[model samples]
Structures are given as structure tokens and as C-alpha cells.
Target: MRGDTSPADGDKLGREAPIPRQLQQVQDDDLDPDSVKRHEEDDDDDDDADEGRDEEVAGLVPRLSDEEERSARRARNEGGAKLGRATTTYREGDDDYDDEDHLNHVEDGGGSRSPFADRREQRARRRKPAGVLATIWAIAREALPTLAISVLSLVFSGELLIHLARWPVFVKVDKLFILVPILLNLKGNLEGNLSLRMSTSANIGELDIRRTRETLIFGNLALLQVQALIVSLFAGILASVLGVIGGLGGASEGPKTAQRRGFGALLTKRRVIHHHPAPSDPSMRLRNSYFEFVLVIATGMLAASMSSAILGSFMCALVVVTRQLGGNPDNIASPLAGSLGDLLTLTILGLLGSFLVRFEGTILATLILLALAAACACCFFLAYRNAYVRELLSSGWIPLVVAMFISSGAGLVLDAFVQRYEGFALLVPVATGLPGACSAIFVSRISTALHSGKGVSSSLSHSSSSTLISALRDILKLGPTEGWIVPATLFTIGAGIEVLFLVLVWVTGQMSFGWPFAITFVITSGLIVAASLYISHLITLFLWSRDYDPDIYCLPYVTSLIDVIGQILLVVAFATATVLGDQITAAVNDHQKP
Candidate 1:
């Protein structure tokens, strides 16, 4: 009835078998509900002839005229566009999609509907913090053995003083009490820088120990040795000047005079004692001044050279081992360098001073000075040739020298106080070494963080209160463990070392302040270490905020500050220990009387 052709065309199409009524019914049922309803209404309007025509058209794959075919293709394309729009809407309203629909969509090769949501989920999983106990255990496992070795090394540093006690030069030169600590602090500063440079270089793959001469490692090593020589020369001259002025005040008395005059007289005597016994001798004073100068200078040179050689070598090995173990050398190298520098510098100074004092005016003394000068000259020439060495010298050396001078002043304070408190003298190395080591370690860690481009953000350059808060927050984030755990661990280690140091003193028959004094010393040393670490952290953050390199600016000042603070705290601890011990003794006496 709706055919374009006549009855012949209809009959020709009808020659093909028609679809069964059941299949036709299934096909009609599969149509959209609106389409099926419209078709049923259309059937009611057409009656039987039209109904038969609709059944035939539905049963067969209806042929389309050219215009109809074009329209059909356009409709199909429109339906495809609508399907794409529906998929986008479904993804945006992901909660509206059933889990089965989501599964079918994925199974059909559609990617994750919400990629951003998936990424957020992944980030949430990644950002979880480790448990507190686990973090503590990890840091302890990492730090304890190294810290133990550091403490042992610091304790051994007392051997330097013990050996110096055997040296005539130590007694002959009045300024050595001031000079020794200065030189030890200087050596620590230089070597600590070397360790930092090496650790940083190694971290970034710049350090190649096997080919050190061609690498930055060689330049840093050269810089360290040259700086050591230069600083040694400066320290020697400064100490010599102090010695001369000290001689003017009758302070350069020999050990024999000190022993004979009693501790009070020895400390109060302001004139240089001439080797000559007679008091009416002007020549005696001039000769004694020259003796003090030569003694201080020679001892300074020897100490510096020995420390550079031994500590430099030790630092190289330390860097290599730390790198091989995949541990951060910054955390351990500074303390190791500091403790070893103290032990070796003091011990070497004593040994060389003992020998040098024996030949003070002899040709051997002249030969030693000439040799030291020659060695220093050779090292300087080599350092001058290196570009990195030159840069380090220009940028870094002056601050270090200034810091050493300040440390020398701290040493002077210790020397002045040593005569008043006998136990104080014995505790000086422990007081100075432990806190210095702790601060040095922290400085190294902060320096490494700054270098590695972590922790400190560049936005902190504003120096505003908000920026300061941000900078502090960055520091906390950098080493959250450092704030509490590190300080506590350092305090525990320091207390143990203090106990060991006092025991060593008592065992060696050096000085016996007894158990109450020991308890005071332990508590004080722990407090000093905690305070020093906190100060170090503050200094590091301040320097880092200002875009200053903490490695060069921080270690020297911190170590020097620790020396001053350690000495004051030591004195306080001694006073507290004495009062507490006296009270305990009085209580015991009163109880016994009852």
C-alpha cells in the first residue's frame, strides 16, 4: 500500500519469506516505549490494511529511498552525539551511575570516569605518616651507633689534656690554656666544612674519591689544608701577642713557680717568671717574653699541621664509608670531625710541644719552623691554583677566622675560671666537645637540607612574620624528629659521656668530685646539649631564611657559642653539685647523731 512501485514490485518483494509473528512481536517489544505506543496509535488510525502494511514493513528490513537513507544516516550520527553527551553527563554525576553500569563501562574499554578522583585517592594513600614509635625506632637505629662512637671519641679527646699535662710547654706557655681550645675549635670548624662539602658533593655525585684530583673533592681538601695553615699562622701570631701581653702582667710563670707559689698565687701573679731565679733581673723578663711567644707560635703551628693531616684523612674515609652505606654523611660527619679534631689536635699539640720545647733555641727548632713554613707555602700554592679553592678562600675563610678568634676568647674565659674550680678544669673537654659535636651535627644536617633543595622554600625570602612562621614550619617538616627526639637522644648520650668522663678523671687520679658532683655534671651536660641543639636549629633557620649558606656561617659560630655556654653551664653545675653534696653530708651527720 505504501510502495513506490506497482503491484509487480510488491509481489517481487513479497517473494522473500516474512518474519514469523513471534519474532515480529519480539522486535516490536524491543522498540522504545514511546515509539511502540506511537506505532500502536498509528495502527488504530489506519485500520486492517495499514496494520498489515506496518507488520510487513516491520517484518522486513525496510528499504530506504536515497533521501530517507541520507536522513537515516544523519539521525544515526545525531544519536551518536547524544550518546557521547550522555556518557559525559554520567561521568560528571558519578553517584548517579550504578556499580553494574560502572563495571560495564570499564569492561567496554572506557577509562576511569573520574581520573582526577583516582589521582586524589592515590595521593591520600601516599601521604600517610609513619607511626610515632616506628619513626623513633628508625631514627634511633640510624643515629645511635654513630652517636656512640662520637661520644667515645669525645671522651678520648681528654687524652689530649692528659698528654698536655705531661708537656713542659703546656706549663711553660701561659697562653696555651687560651690557645689550645681556639686551635681545637678552628680545626673542628675547617674539617666540619670539609665533611659538609664532601657529603654534599657525594650526594650529588660530584665526589669521586678515586679520581679526587680531577674533582671538587680535591679542591675542598686543598682548601681545608691551606685554610688550616693560614688560620694556624693567624692563631700563632694572636696567641704570641697575647703571650707577650700576658708576660707583661707577670702571668707567664713556669710550672715550677706555679707549683711552689700555690694555685692562688700562680693565678694572680702577673709577671713573666724568667728562668733565672733572681728577681732583680731585667734581662730575665725580656728572655721570658721571647720564650712565651716562641712557645705559643710553635705549638700553634704544630697543632694546626697535625690536625689538618690527621683530621683531613679521617674525614675522607668517613665520607667514603658513609656514602657506601647510603647513610647521610651530613648527620654524622661533623660530630666525627669535631671529636676527632679535638682529640688529635690536643694530643698532637702536646706531643709536638713536648719535643719542640726541648729544642726551643736549637737548630732543630729553626729547621722545624722552616719546614712548617715550606710545607705551608707548598700547600698554599697548590690551593691557589684551584678555582674552587680560591672561591672558598675568598668567601669562607674570613668568617672562619673570626669565629676562631671568638672561640679563642671563650678559651680565655675557661682558662681564667680553671684556677678557681679544680673540677672545672677536668670537665672542660667534655663540656666543650659534646655540645660542640651536637651542634656541628645539626648544622651539617640543616646545610644538607638547604643544599638538596628540600625543607626551606624559596618563598621565605620576604622575612615577614608569616614568612618566619612558614620558614619555621618548613624546618619542623624537614626534621620533625630533630625537635624532640634528636635533642633527647643527644641529652642521653651527653649524660652518659659526662659520667664516663668524670669516671675517667676519677680513675686517672686527675680529680675526684665524687658521685654527687658526677650527678650534677651529668644533668648539666644533658641540659647544655639540649640547649645547644635548639640554638643550632634557630641559627640554621635564621641563616637559611636570609639566603646565607649555613655550612660556612653556622658551624663556626655555633661551635664557638657552645664553648662559651658549655663553660658557664659547667660552672653552674659544679656549684649546684657542691651545695647538694654538702646538704647530703650534713643530713647524714645529723642522722648518725640521732
Candidate 2:
């Protein structure tokens, strides 16, 4: 009705739209122009009449050309306003409706939106969850090459034994075959324990190698020295006893030849020689045994002490450096150190043997022994004075010592069978070193898991598969790849080393066997890696579930088992090669006859 214009008033009515009742009441109050404007503003601010005003503006507006109307609507929509308005108005209590009003903002490219919000949304969309398979692939991607190189380094340790085999002292002392593996394995086991200890300490914030934590460093070093001395001395004594038992009631001709001549020949030769009593004095036998004893003990002490000092310091530094670099020392320290320990210990033992053998029963031997014993005593005293050393001794030292003895028995077994194969002696260091290297890797992983509280419960039952699964999950969480990748890679490295070593041995004329022997060596090396990995996993799981520190217990046990298993496998391989190799060689020789 207000917009209806009479025919006579059409021009006048066209000049203005009808005022609403609210503004008309303000106009009737006789307000000044500015006051009237203020009153009109008050009417426009009314929230309840917003819809009516919008409808009035839409309905009462003059008609536009079709193109103009479309353009106006497009502008209104694009600007996120009401259909006829140029600006948006958010109601006082309707902020939630703002998204609806701005729906076209996205269609307009959203350039007016906050960049950080858009970026956050984009990131959210991009960050999909990494499933189990993806995780395994990622972990294996990082670990495979590192493990391969580490294993390859260990495989080369076989060269040390090759050199040792050519040493005059090693040749003269038949019992060293029984002692070398034990001592080498002992060095790895001991250093591996030190690595684990240092890794755990670093993880727990106890490790500080900057001389301010000298007590902890000295305490650990002392414990390592004492453990090394005790274990190596015990290993030396145990190996000597086994050698005596195996060597007794036999001919003076080397055990290798005596075994080939048949036991009856050996015993008859012993009896005949006894009845006809060679002029050699019994004291000569005692003197020889004593000389072997001095050599084993002296070399053992030197190897243990020197390896502990050098490798212990190195592993500790490695762990510290890795941690500072935001990497897991657990992944790198043990494997690297284990391989290095094998090479260094064997080289050092060979050198010590060369020097000590020259002084066997001389006053120089006594002086060396006294000096070594005094140094060992000083280390033991320092270790005894440290509370941490006392704790390690009470809980950790005995198992390690026992493991050394058990590993010495494995050496005994190797000595018995490996003698039959002429150049199979070269396999000893590689076999023992490879397993220890693998065990060190796995033990470090498990120890890190334990220290980080990532898997297994403190009170979990030892037989629980959940504990094993948890432990495995901790490792497997590194990727979708199975745990066997490490062992398989190790096996590959070992096989390659076997092939290379065989070629070297053949080229050097140290061995006469052909591809059959090489194949057997490679196969045995693979089996050793696989067995070592499995045994290490089981040992770590057992120690972890039992609430014992796997670091202290795992290395020795795994390495000891590896020694035994590796020796057994090497013997089996050699026996297989011996039987089939002879036939293969004969066939080839027959074929070659022109």
C-alpha cells in the first residue's frame, strides 16, 4: 500500500520509497536532520526486522535490464552477501551461519582465506597413516646396507686367522686352535656387553664421557678389564684341560695325523713306546704343558686387557657420538664393534703369541706374567672399589665366565674335527666372528628396546609369546620387512667372503680343494649366520622376559652357541666335502687325462 502511487502522484512517489513505521515514528518526533539520520540508523540496527528489510529492498528495487540483473546477482553471490546487497552482514547470534554465507568463497579460489589455515588443511590431507607393510619396508631400507657392510667387514676377519695359521707359534702350539676361537669370541662377547651397557646408559641419561663422569667411565672400564681377565684366564685354563684330555694316550705325532692313523695305531704306538721307553724325560712333557699354559694365560690377559681398553673406549665413544647425532647407537655400535673386536683381538692375540712364545720358560716370561698380573690386580682393585662394578660382578660376571668355558668347549670340538680339513682352519675366524657380529646386532637392538621401555612387561612370564611378539614388534616396527633380512644379508656377505677367501687361499697355494670345498664353505657360512640370528633372538627374549639384562647375558650366550653351532656345521661341511670332494676331484682328474 505504501508503494502504491496515485496517477497524479506517480512522479512524486517515484522519487522515494515509503518509510517503514519505525522510521516514520522518528520523523514525527520533530528531530533535526542529523537526529533523523541517527534514528534511521537505530531502525536499521534492529535484528528482528532484518528479513523484512531484505525483502523490502529486493521487492521494491527498480527493475534492472536482464544483463544488469544477472551481473548484480553474480556480484552479490560472489561477495558472499544477501542476493540484492553488496556486503555480507553476520547476525549477532548467528556466527555459525557465516560458513553458509561464504560457501561461494571456495568457488572464488579462496584467495581471501588465511594461508596458514589452508596449508594446515593441505598437510592434514597429505599425512595418511603409514601401515605396517610400509613401516617394514622403510626400516629394511635403512638397515640392509649397513648390516651388509658390517657383515662383510666381519667376513674379512677370516684373513686374520689365515695369517695366524702361518705363524710359527700357532703352528707349534696345537692347543691354540682350541684357544683362538674362545678368545676371539670372548673379546666380542665382552665388548658387546660393554656396548650394550653404554647404549643403555646413554639412553637412560647416565652416560657422559666428557671426563666429568669419570667415575662411571672408570667403573665400567674396570669391570670390563676384570671380566676380561677372569674370563680369558678361565677360558685359557679350560682350553688347556680339553687339549690334555684329547691329546692324552696318543702318539707324539700330531693329533691330526694320529687320528688319521686310527686309534688302535695310536694306542699301540703309545704302548710300544711305553714298553720301549724313549729316552725323553717325563719332565719334558710337563715342561711343554707348562709352556702352553704360560702362553695361553699370558696371551689371554694381554688380549683381554688390550681389547677392553681400546674397544671399550671406542664403543663408548661411538654410542655417545651416535646419540649426539640423533641416531640410535644400538643399531650401529654392536655390529661394528663386534666385527672390529674380532679382527683386533685375533691380530693382537697372534702378535702376543709370537712375542710370548719366544719367552716361554725364560726369566722374561716370569717377568711378563708378573707385570700383567700386577696390572690386572690394579684394574681389579679399581673395579672392586666401584659400586657399579660390584653390582656387575655379583650379577653378570659368573654367567659370562661360564659362557667363556662353554665356548672354549666349542673350540675344543672345532679343534677335534677342523684338523681333518687342511685349510678349513681359515673358516674358524669367519665362522665365529660372523655369529658374534650378528649376535651383537640383535643384542643391541633388544637392549635398546628394554632401555626405552618400548616392549615387554617387567613382570611378564618368561614363556609368554606376547613378550616375544612384543620384542619382535619393536624390531619389526622399524619396517614391514621381517627380522630375517639381517641374517639373510649376513649370510650373503659370509658366502661372498667364503668365495673370496677360497680364491685367495687357492691362489696362495695354501689349499688344494676345488669348487666343492668352496661351495661347502659358503653353505656352512650361511647356516652359521641363520643359526646365530635365531639363537640371538631367543637369548635376548629369554633374558628380557626373565627381567634380566640381556646386554650382560645375551652376548656371551649367543656367541657361545654360535661357536658351538658354527664349529659343528663347519665339521659337517668338511666331512661332506671330504666324501664328495674326493669323488668330484677324481672325476675331474679322470676327465683331464688326455
Candidate 3:
């Protein structure tokens, strides 16, 4: 087959696969661009636009055979390049940068247009500004429904937290508040990262073969199990550390505070304000208990491991199905993974924790924790044995740890202002999650484009200087012509969702904010999502240029950053509503007079 090398050739090359016939032909002066287009056309007959992009990149960007595709992923420090005809040169000096022409840069090519070139003469003409508009409209038409469903699902997670907060498991369990949000944040990152990576793997033809598909899917699933366990353990430790701080006199608040949201507290006869439910026996300091510490770890590990297993498999299958159904998984997978991860992880933590709390000091709890450790170790061994995910065992830890620290800092912001306004906690998901969902989608698309080997064969594919150039264009350039179409469409949808969230809260009487605060909420959330989309673009470029896997690097930090930013924006929206919302202030005053 001209598509991939034979099994014997793959063995002879060790880990690297051979270049395709069209790519090798690029070295010959007799190479015909039209012929290359024909081969690709037969391979992807349904996609008319990608034909041009394939022809364009074949003459420009060079790809490696690698140790990981046939074995595509190589070691982090290893630069295993086998250029066919074109050459790439990265310049640090500003002089080499084409300030005027974003797409033309350091390339020794066989007369191929860079995948990222904003060359209006060739591409922009066919896609008139109207075509660009239509392009984004098509993207929006498919994507908005998925984004909406994902965002709506977060309400269940938020509601779960609200309902589960008052459970005795939370009271008896030390720092469950501190533990749950961190686990959810970390787990969300893991699942979203899995979705993004799977989408990239699938689009690049990595999963086209049954053998390769099995390796990638199973290896990644094993890898997820390991990551989830480690991250869960980290969550338990952070909660303990924060609980220690609370004991020594700093306040620790988390998703549990969401339970006390709304102004109903203002009208209630008794003033009952506490970070978590007070124990019936005031003498017991739950935070200091040895058993509580072990249970916290147990609960987090159990919940995170189970959630990752469920969400990771679901993400893999979903991406595969989306690809099979002739849809881009990039449009749907990542956001849904994030939303479902949070909801599933939280629910498991709450319900399982309640059951486990009954066995806290017993041998049963200890046995369960040990068994989980053994199970995670088994998954780690499975991950290490697989060529596709072997390296992941060592990679991606720093980002996860860093994200935890960030989300932990966000706890301070949440603790300070969560009780200050009505429906603040209820709205946290839609506010923060909408932007995060947008960023995950953006990051996944950039990652797929950046690593798809075929250059920007589709809107989902990028290369070095060209990659950065296109990232800027794709994220920033707008209007009827060029890059603005997809981004603007996503932002438009995000803005609509943001406004809808506020309306839902207000109409349901869960919150009372006047025009001023409603306006503030819309403006603030809009900016946050805009910033999130742009930041995802930047982070993906940064990681990619460094030769690090952007799939692992991009999604985690963006989601965590959104957590902090979303909560701060919520507080700002609330502060605005409390001060400038005459309707709210009047209601509070009226209620107080009675």
C-alpha cells in the first residue's frame, strides 16, 4: 500500500515509518502537485477544501516518520526528523520574522504554500469574505448545539454539589470541600486532555488501522487511569494542607459553599454561617483526626479513578464515533468530557464517600485504599508496556500539579465572595465552564492542526512558524474574510450561552440582579471567554514550538486558569449586583426591615 509501509519495512526502520510516495516525490523536479491532489482526493473524496491545503503543505512543511505514529511519539528531548524534500528553519532574531506577511517565513520548500499562509491572492479570493462568513456559520451550526448540551450538563454538577453539601459525609469527612473541587478540576483536565489527544490521533489517520487504533485507545485509557489516581492523591494532600491551614486559622471553602447560595439566607430567622456543616459533637475536630485523613485520600482516589475510567473511555469512543459519522470530534469531544468529568466525579465522590464514611476507621477502608493503589499500579504497568502511551507515564505531571496549585488559590476567591451574592455559586459552572469549554475546543483544534502531519490538510491541522502565524490568524483575524469566521462564531455562541445562564438564574428567582449587574455579567463573561479562546491559542503555540506535546500542556492550564478567572468574574458580577443593582439592594433592605 502506498498509504503506509509494510510490516517488514516498519520492523526494518525500527520505530520510524517511511514517507508516503507523494512526499518522497517532492524531492524530484518532476513532482506534479495535481497528481498529489488526486491521490489525496481518492483518500478523502468528500472533502473538497482539504485538497488545496494538502497540495499546499506537501511542498512546504516536512514531517518525521517518528517512533510513535507507526510509532509517532518520540522521546521529549529527541529530535527525530527525516525531512523528505522541504526544510524548516526556526529563527530567534526578529529580522527573520516577516512582520508584513504573516505566513511567509523561514522555509526551504519544493514550491508549496505554507499551511498557515494568509496569502489572499491564492486562498482569500476563492473564499470571499462571504465564504469566510459561511465557513464560520457552518462551524457554528454544528458546534453550538454540542457546546450548549455540554454547558447545560454542568448545571447538574453544580446542583449535585449544592445538594450533596449538607450530607453527613461532608460533615464527618475532613476537608471534603477542599478535596472535591480539586479532584473535579484535576479530573476535568484529564478527561478534556484525553478528548483533545484522541481527536488529534483520530484525524491524523492514526486510528484508521485496527491495530493502531487498539494500541492508541487502550494505551491512552491505561494512561488515564494512572493520571487520575495520582491526581486524586494530590487532591487529598492539598485538602489536608488546606485543612491544616484552616485549623491554624485560615478559612478554607470550596464547592460545598455552593449549597448555601442565594439570598434565602438573608430571610432565614437564624444566622447560620459556616464553611462546612458543624459536627453535632462540637468537641470533635474532624480535621485533626487520623482516620479522616485516610478517608479523604480514599474517597478522592476512589472517586477520581472511577470517573477517569468512565469519562476517558467515553471520550475515546465519542471521538471515534464522531470521526466515523463524518463529523469533527474537535467540535464536540473536549467540552463534553470536561462537563461530564465534573458531574460524574462529584457524584461518585459524594455517594461513594457517604458509603465509605461508614467504614472510615475500619480495616475495610484501609483494604480498599490499598487495593486501589494496587490497581493503579497495574494500570501504570499496562501504560508503560504500550508503545503509544509509554512515554505518557513520565510526561504531563507538571501541568497537572501546577493546575492544582492554581485551583487551590481560586478557593480563596470563592470563599470570600460566594456568600455575598445570590445564585453566585449556581452560576459558577456556566460562567467559568463556558469559557473553559471554548478554550478546550480551541486548544484541541489547534493541537490537531499542529500535529496532523498532513499540514493544515483541514481546518483542524499546523507547522512551526506557519503554525504560529496561522494560530494568530485563526484566532484573531475576523469578518467576512479569513480567520475571524470560526472564532467569531464560537464567541457569538459563548456570548449567547452566557446571557442565557443569567436569564435562567433570574427567571427562576435563584438570583435577583437588575439591569446594571446583568449587563456587567454579560460583559465580564464575554471578555473572559474571549480571553480564554485567545489564551488557549497562545498556550498551544507556546508548547508546540518548544517540542512539548501541546495536547498534554494546553488543556489543563486553560481550564484551571478559567476556574480562577471565572470565579473572580462571578465575584465581580455579584459585587456589581450588590452595589449597583437597585432591585437587589431594595429587596435586601425590604427583607431586613421585617
User: lDDT for each of the candidates?
Assistant: 0.60, 0.60, 0.67
Residue 209, model 1: Cα distance from true site in angstroms = 8.5
Task: For residues 25-144, write the lDDT of model 1, one tens digit per residue.
Answer: 448678567666654553343344344334333432122332332233333333321111112211122332224544333222232123433443455457666666765565566555
Lowest summed lDDT window (length 10), candidate 3? 83-92
Tens-digit lDDT string for candidate 2 (108-189): 2222332333443455557776666664454454444555566566656765665576677765665666677667666667
Off by over 4 Å in 2: 1-157, 171-178, 208-213, 239-248, 251-286, 289-296, 405-432, 458-530, 567-594
Error of 1 at 94 (Å): 46
> Which 10 successive residues of model 1 have the least lDDT summed?
81-90
Each prediction's Cα RMSD?
Answer: 23.7, 24.0, 12.5
**What does the lDDT read for residue 550 in candidate 3?**
79
lDDT for 139 (candidate 2): 42
Q: Per-residue lDDT for 63-145 in model 3, tens only? A: 23332432232211122332211122211121212232322221221133333332422343464345775678667866798
- Candidate 1 deviant stretches above 4 angstroms: 1-138, 169-178, 208-214, 251-257, 260-299, 362-371, 416-422, 461-488, 495-523, 580-594
